[model samples]
Target: MTAYDPIELKRIRWRSRRGLLELDLVLERFFAQRFDSLSPAEIDAYKRILDLPDTDFLDVVNGKADLDDPEEAAIIEILRAV
Candidate 1:
């Protein structure tokens, strides 16, 4: 499996800290639980989603909306549980 470079993981972790508290908390939990095991595909999917506005990102994570790609959708499903 492809591994995230340490710098890349750091960048992702930092970005995951959203302006929205609820989203931030959920993302923190997600990282705590799953960061180590994440597939490179899942990491890339998350990077795409992270480009959304904080509110929009929260909506996606909270399942009130969806992403277009199947990889993104799969990651979002995993996110919902966290």
Candidate 2:
């Protein structure tokens, strides 16, 4: 149960859209732990995005949203990667 740095989380938030860094980190950790058998930080970010409207989410990624939200940017980044 290695502890993840909250400051790193903050930096991730500051540098990325809302919780993108945290979400990416969490997903990476989850897969690493489950498939690689590595103990990593718990990921709880997907829960937030799961409920967001598709248009709002797409708008954020497309840079058409006016909310100036970071989480949207993060979603775009992830979506593009996949």
Candidate with top lDDT is: 1
Model 2 residue runs over 4 Å out of place are: 1-43, 66-75
Supply the TM-score for candidate 2.
0.32
lDDT of 1: 0.86
For model 2, what is the alpha-carbon lDDT of residue 36? 30
Instruction: Give each model a TM-score.
Output: 0.91, 0.32
lDDT of 2 by residue, 11-55 (tens): 434432334544455445434444132223222233344345655
**Could you tell me the lDDT of residue 37 within candidate 2?**
26
Question: In candidate 1, what are the lDDT values of residues 1-82, reduced to their tens digit?
Answer: 3567779988999988888899888888888887678888889988898899999888888778988899989888888987
Q: How large is the C-alpha RMSD of every model relative to the true structure?
A: 1.3, 10.7
Candidate models: Cα lDDT each: 0.86, 0.42
